[model samples]
Target: MTIRTAFKSMSVAELTRKLASAETASLLLALVEMTGDTAPLDRWGKWIQGPTPINAEFPTAEAEEIRAQVADLLIERGAQTERLSEDSERFRALTAAATDRVIPDAEKPLVLKEMGLLDEAFVDWSAVRPDRADQFPVVIIGAGMSGIATAIHLERMGIPFVVLDKNDEVGGTWLVNTYPGCGVDIASHYFSFSFAPKSDWSRYYAKQPEILAYLKDIVRTFGIGEKIEFRTTVQSVSYEEATQEWVLEIRTGDGPARTMRAKVVVSGVGALSTPSVPELPGRGEFRGKVCHSAEWDPTIDVTGKKVVLVGNGASANQIGPAIAPDVERLTVLQRSPQWVNGVTGYLDSVPEDEKWVLSNIPAYERWFRVRTMLSMNDVMRPAATVDKNWDGPEGTINEANEKLRERLIGYMRSELGERQDLLDQMVPDFPPMMKRMLRDNGWCRMFRRPTVELVTGAASRFTENGIVDEHGREHEADIIIFATGFTAARMLSSYEVVGRDGVSIRDVWGEEDPRAYLGLTVTGFPNLFILYGPNTNIGVGGSIFFQAEAQSTCIARLIRDMIERGASSAEVRQDVFEDYNRRLDQEMETLIWSLPVGTTWYRNSKGRVTANMPWTSADYWNMTRSTSLDDFVVRYHDDERGTAHADDIYRELDSDVARTH
Candidate 1:
C-alpha cells in the first residue's frame, strides 16, 4: 500500500509516530491539511493577517530533521541547491542589502548557520545600477498578479502608476477558478514575491482562498487598491504621433464610454483569461447546465449528476479527481493522453507549531523559501529542451522523464489491479516534461472508485444529449465541461491600439503571431509594455510569481530611467527587436515546445511557437534587470501635454458603488 493510504488508515498515536520520521512528515502534514480536525482551513476565513506568531518552538533535533529532509529532496532532484559560502566577504555585502527582501532577522541566526546564507552569493539588481533610478506615469491593463506586482515596484520607487481591470475583482485567475481541488502545484514558500513573503500560509501548496486573500492583503498593505479602476474594460487604444501619448477608450460597467491617455500602456490581461471551447458539433444543444472549469458554478449541483470532462490539461487533471466522489457518474473524455508526474501533496494547512517557527525564526523560513525557489521553481526548466536522440514514442527527456514515468506507472499498477485495459487507456505513450506535468496525488487512487470512468480516444464531436466519441459511442452527461485550454499565442487580442501615425497594433501583427522585445514592448508600438505577454509563459515548469516579479522589476526600471532622462517615449528599434526575436526563435528550435510531431496547443497553425519562452526564469531575470536606451529609440520632448503611464487610465467610482443601503 502507498504511504498515503497507510496514513489515512492510521490511528492518532500511530499517525504521530509515523509523522516523527522526517521522510513521512510532509506526507502526514498533507493528510492532516486535507482531512485533519485540529485545524480547519475554512475557519481561518479571508485576508492575510501577517506573520504567524511562533507561540511554541520545536525541539532542536526535530527542527533540524525537517530541514535535513528538505535538503535531501533537493539533492535527490540534482538541482543547483548549494548555498553561498559563509566565509566570503562579498556574500556578506549582498546579504546585508538583501535582508529586507529575503532574510528574516529573528530566524536568521539558526537559518544562516544551517543554510550557509552569508557565504552564499546573490545578484542584487539594486546594486548593479544606482544610476538606474528613473520615473514615469505608467498605464497597466488587467488587475491580476502581474499588474499588481508592477504597481508594487513602482510604488517603492515613489513612481506613480495606475492599473485598469475589466473584471470587478482584483485576483484575476484566482477570482475565476473556484473548483474543489484548485490550488498551486508549486510550494507557497517559493510561489510568493521575495519582497513581500507570506510566512503564515496554512499549507505548503496554498489553496485558492489563501492565495486570493494574499493578493487582497498585498493590495491593502501596499495601498495598491487606490490605483485600480474596476469594471472598466479597455476597448481600443490609439497613439498620436504629434503628441506621443496613448489615448485609450474604456467602457464602464453600466456602458458609459470614455477615453484616457497615458505616456505608456501595459497590458496584463493574462493568457488563460479567455477559455477555448472546442469547435465541436451540437455544442450549443447541451440541454442541462454546462460550464468551463474556469467559469465553475458554485451553486450548481454536481451531486447525483452525470458529468463529462473534456481535455486532460492542468484544469482537467485537477477537476477530474476532485469531483469524482461527489457526482453520481463521472466520465473524463480524453482526446490525447498526458503524463502525470507523482502528486506532490501540499493542499493541507500548515501545522500551528511549524507556522509559528516559520514566522519567529528570522532566516529559517526565508532561507527555506529560497531553497524551495531554486529547487521547485528554477531547477526543472532545463529538461524542457527536446533531445534529438529522444526518438521514442514521445514525451519527457533525460532522467526526469524516466523517473516521472516510473512514479506514474507504479501509481497506475497500484490503482488498477485487475484491469490492465483501464491502466493502458489511462497511460500515455510520451515521455514526461515534453509538455506540462500535472499533480494530483489523489488522482490515481480516485480512479479505483466504481463511479468514475476514464474514456480513452474520445475524439469528441459534441452531440445533443452529450458527446459522441470516436468509436461511435454516445455518452450522455447532464453537464459538459470545456476544459479546452485557451488562446495563448494571440497576445493582447482585444484593444486595437493605433500607435505612432495611426498604426493599429492588430494591423502590425495580423493573426499570424505577436512578437515583443523581452515580452515587454513592441517595435512599432512605442512606450507600450506588457506583463505575462507573448512568449513569456514559462515554457517549462517554474513559478508564475517569479516571471511576474521579474517583468515588474524590468518595467519599473524602464519608468525610472524615463523620469530621470526627462524623455517622452522610448520605442524599441526595429532592427533590435527583430534581432532579439531571431535569436529567440533559434533558441526555441531545440526546445520540446517546438516539436512538430506532436499536436500541442503550444504550436500555432503558422508553425510559430509564440506562447512559451525558451530560457530559465533566472536568465530572463538577468536580461530584464535594467533598461538601456541603446535597445530603444529615446524620444526627447519638453511639453506640458506629455503624461505618465497611469494618469488617464483609472478613475474613482461614484459614492453609490461604495454605498450599502
Candidate 2:
C-alpha cells in the first residue's frame, strides 16, 4: 500500500503504540506538520533538549501523555486535512523546537529543503529549455551515489545522459569493499539522499551489503539501470574547443579502446576508488597472502591462521574485532591512535515498531531525517573549530574540543578497565575531531582477547615468513591485510583530463593539492564538473550523500542555464577560481584538520587540508543553491564571447512561458 493509504488506515490505538516507539521530538514535529497544530510543541518542548533531541529521555508518564495526544490529533485533524501549514512562522517554530535551537530567517529555506519540504532542485525545462537542448548530451562517470543522483536529476529534466561505471554493477565503493565487519559509521538515515529516503533500513548504521542493495534498488526504481554502461572504464577525457565537446577514451572488459563525445562531462569518480598501500621493503618476499581492504578476497579463509594487519585506521578498527575470534592470532600494526566514540547501539538493528512508524506515518520519516541531519551535521561543528586563544594543555585545540577529548577518554578508560597498557596505546595524542571519528564496534573489547595484539609502530620491511617493524622486530604471519586507505589527496587520479589550451589537470593539480571553485568546476576545464571533489570531504559534521546532492543540484542548474542561454561552453573565470580558493584556505586555518595532528589522509603532503571542506553543509548548500552567469566566461556557437546577464535570461524565459501558455 502507498504511504498515504497506510497512514489513513492506521487505527488510533495502533498509531499510539507505534508513536511510543518513535522519537518524541520527531513525533511532535510530524504531528504539527500533519494537523497544523503547534500545541504539542509547547507541551513537550521542554523535554526536547540536547545536541540530538531525538535521543532526549522524557518522564514515563509524560512520554505516554505526549504519544496519546499525538495519536488523537492525527486521527481527528491530520487524517482529514489535505493542506498542511506552509506558513514561514510555523515552519521556523517547528524547526527550532525539533533542533533545540533558533532557526534564523535566512537559514529557514535551507532547513526546509533539507526536510524535503521544498523542491528547489527542480528545473522547469518546458519554459527555459533552448531549441537545441537535445543536441547537448551529458556523460556521467562512475555509477555510484553521486552519479546515480546526477542521472536522476537529468532524467527529471528530460535531458539526454549516459552513466558509466568500471564495475559490472552499481554501488562503486560499496560493491567493492566487502571486508569483514564493513559498515557505515554514520547513521543510516543521515547517510541517504533527502529525495530518495529508505525508511526500512535494517540497522541504525547499515552494513555494506544492505547499503549496496539500497543503491541498486534506487537504480531500478528510477529506471537508471538501463542508462548505465557497466564494466566501462573512462581512461581519459580531452576537451575539444573546436566542437565544444569532451572526447572520452574508454575501454570495456578487455575490449579495444573506443572514443565517445559529449557536450558536458561530470566526473563522479570519488577520491576513495583507488587503494593506497605503503611501500614497504621486501613485500614480495613475504610468503603470506597480501590484499588491501578494498580488494578483499573472501575465498582466502583466515580461520585458525595467523594474520598481521597493517594500518590501524577506520577499516582496521572494524576488521580486527571481526576476525579476532576466528583467527588463531591477530596482530594490528598501528602508526597512530584514532579517537573512537562508543555508541550504544552501533551493531543493533532498527526495531520493527520504529520502522512501522517511519514507513506508515505521513511526515515522521522527514522529521526524523531532519533531526539526524541537524545532530550529525552542524551541531558538533564547534568542537572542530580552532581557538587560537585556547589555554588548554597539549593535544586539545579549544575548550569544546578539550571537553570532547575528556569524554572520549573517560569512555575508553571504562572500556579498558584494568588494561591500561591497551588504553595508553589507544588514546590519541591529538584532538578528538582531527581525523574522521570512528564508532566503537568492539574495537576496545577486542584488545582484551588473548590472541589479539596491538603493535605500536610502522612496518619497515617484510621477511620470507614474517613482517619486520621499525624497531627491527619480526612478527610471524600467514596473512597480511593492508587496511591502508585510499589515495584521497589525489582527486580523479584514475583517469587523465586534458582541458583548454592543452593543459593537463594533473599538471595543474600536481601530485596532490587539488583546488576547485565550490568543489565543482575548475579554471581551465570548461563544461566539466566534479562531484565529491577536492575540499568536499566532511571531516567532522554532515553526510557525503548530502554533499553529493548539493553538488548535483548545482551542476544541474549550471547545465540548465547553459541551455537556456544558448551557450556553446561556460568556464569559471580564473580570478573567481583563485578568489574562492584563497577564501577556502583562510577558512581552513580555523578548522581542526589544519592543525598539526597525527598523520591523516585529510591533509596532503604539503600539510594543506585538501580533502575536507571547511564550511558547514548548510553553508555549502546555500552557496550552491543557484548559479550566476556572471561567474563564468560564456561563448556562443558563432564564436561570440561574453557573459549573459541572469536577469535578462530569466525575463526571456518568463516571456517564453507566457507566450506558450
Best by TM-score: 2
Summing lDDT over every window of 10 consecutive residues in candidate 2, give the lowest-scoring window: 77-86
Per-candidate TM vs. native? 0.77, 0.95
User: Which 10 consecutive residues of model 1 have the lowest summed lDDT?
Assistant: 44-53
Q: How far is candidate 2 from the true structure (C-alpha RMSD, Å)?
A: 2.5
**lDDT for predicted candidate 1 compared with the true structure:** 0.65
C-alpha lDDT (0 to 100) for residue 216 of candidate 2? 96
Give the per-residue lDDT digits (tens) of candidate 2, residues 1-661.
Answer: 1354444467878888878778877877777777667787888777778536436777888878878877877666554433333455567568778766776666776666766657674545647555677988999999989999999889888789999999999998999999999989888987887777889998988999999999999898888888999999999999998888999999999999999999999999998999998888898899989889999998879999999999888899889888999999998898888887888667989998988878867577877887887777766688999999998978998888999999999988887766777888889998888888888988887888889888999888989998998978999999999999999998889999999999999889998979999999998999999999999988877788889888998888888777866677889988889998999999999988888767789999989998998888778888887556668877666654434444344443445543542
Model 1 stretches with alpha carbons more than 4 Å out: 1-136, 389-400, 458-464, 638-661
How does each model score on lDDT?
Answer: 0.65, 0.83
